[model samples]
Target: MFSRFVAWAKRNLPTRESMEANRWLRPVAHRVLEPSLWRFTRRSVPRGVALGMVTGILCPVAQVPLSAIFALPVRANIPVAALTTFITNPFTTPPLWVAAYWIGSRILHFGEGMGVEADAARGWMEWLFSEAGPSLVVGLTLITLVFAVVGYGASALGWRWWIVRKWRARAEARAA
Candidate 1:
């Protein structure tokens, strides 16, 4: 099972020029990542990593689309946007949608305090059309606004920090 998984991962996540680059890059990656791995043992690093993962997993609608936006400004650190993709992992997607629906309901002041079930949220648009056609517009608008605010803010901060660090490193390297 492990070998199969490794094979699949290698096939899907191939690094181009692996033979040439790995000779040098592998050692450098290991050296750099060693400290990062050790730093992950600290509480703050784990918290930051968790926040990044949650932001990626919980804000799928915003994260995926805005990853492109982050990619534009921080072209050198595309990996940050790529890492943000973890927010929409297979396990967290359903719950995220349900939460979005619940948030939408709250913002619209409809179904007050009623926890949104996945099935109910999935059919919410249809229900709105039948039961409260006018309210559907309000619900959709509220959902968009809430998601945009949360997603944009989190992704912007993450991307901004990533870009700043990269720029700082380049500047320091030039100075050296």
Candidate 2:
């Protein structure tokens, strides 16, 4: 399973050479193609996951590039960060936004005074501008932060678990 995942990742994810050849990234290719940022170390992977979560949730477009840009400063695993941005795609975005709007409304209580009738009278655009807009923004911000923290912690724990499992299997093989 892990080998399959590695194969898939290699086929799909961008390489250092591809990134370096990118017209937009060419100017900063030196920094972006740094060897340390590309390594799948314990420290870098979690940071990459966190950065990817943040960029994936907050950015509407160019999430891969954005994740890469964010990864530069943090010394994150660039490929992992770029791959993680797939969390927020076309199929998932609508539901995610709806949930964000719901959460934001619950937190802000923005709908307390405004009735459906009043909203209808004002028009959907007006209602969105007055109520839904801020709620969505706040909710998205909250979701992004939560995702980042959770992604980082989860990835770190997962990495540790994988390493331990591998060691245990190796020990069993040696004993046998």
Which candidate achieves the best lDDT against the true structure?
2
Best by TM-score: 2
Q: What stretches of model 1 exceed 4 Å from their correct place?
A: 1-70, 74-76, 112-125, 128-176
**Candidate 1: minimum summed lDDT over ten consecutive residues — where?**
37-46
Give per-residue CA lDDT, model 2, range 32-143, as digits (tens): 8899999999999999999998899899999998898889888999998998998999899999999999999999898788777876688778878888999999999999
- List per-candidate RMSD values in Å: 12.7, 2.0
How many residue pairs clash in all the candidates, one count each? 3, 0
In candidate 1, the residue pairs with backbone N, CA or C atoms under 3 Å apart (3 or more residues apart, or in different chains) clash, namely: 56-87, 57-87, 57-88
In order, the Cα lDDT scores of the candidates are 0.48, 0.92
lDDT of 1 by residue, 58-172 (tens): 4546563344233332231223333435656678666665665665555557655557684376576667664354444454445445554575566556766877999999999
Candidate 2 C-alpha RMSD relative to the actual structure: 2.0
